[model samples]
Target: MQRWKQYGGLSGLFAAFLAAGYWGFTATGGALPWAKRSSKALQRGIQEGGGGLVNLGRGIVVAGPIRKGGMMLEFGGLVLLLLLLGIGMYVYVDRYGGFGDGERASR
Candidate 1:
């Protein structure tokens, strides 16, 4: 219940998550590969001239590493988790209203 304990726990959690993210980023070849991909895409776009900005037939393109590495299921799961979290928060807010003090506002 102490404030210091709460702060320490939060700091520890943040450090753990930051380390894990850095590990993931390094293991996945970091930003170099992505930079190269972006450069090539830009050059190709310049060479190819104009086309329809929104092509319904093409659909959305998943990143090459994720698609090639077969992380689609993990990606989908993360997306679903975030979507559920957002909806849950929305429902909780709608049911309980906001944190504003109604009495203070009326004064």
Candidate 2:
């Protein structure tokens, strides 16, 4: 595509290098090491502090989890933040329109 070509050749080369690195890592038996490390680190930090920035934001969106007949749904913490982020995005699009249209009301 012209857009891909419009990017300097280095972009394509960089993408190729990234793909090759991922392929080599997978071939060498690395199973999503980045994801594993990030999750463990996040969990450790949260456990040590009992709550972090995400917890604060979650508090704004949810009071706590809800429990029903033997079923429980976690609404507080990161889950609430994610929900808030999604709803915020929807509200933004509803007010300002979505991507790819390029037209917007002048401020």
**Which is the leading candidate under TM-score?**
1
* Backbone clash count for every predicted candidate, in the order shown: 0, 0
Please name the candidate that would achieve the greatest lDDT relative to the true structure.
1
lDDT against the true structure, each candidate: 0.84, 0.69
Regions more than 4 Å wrong, model 1: 51-107
Candidate 1 local lDDT, 1-107, one digit each (tens): 99999999999999999999999999999999999989999898799885665578975566678989999999889989999999998886666664564543443
lDDT of 1 at 100: 62
Pairs clashing in candidate 2? none
Could you give me the TM-score of model 2 versus the true structure?
0.29
Write candidate 2's Cα lDDT for 11-104 as tens digits. 8888999999999998876867878977998898678775443555464322223433322344435577898999999988778876547666
Each candidate: RMSD to true structure?
Answer: 6.4, 12.8
Among all windows of 10 consecutive residues in model 2, the one with the lowest summed lDDT is 62-71
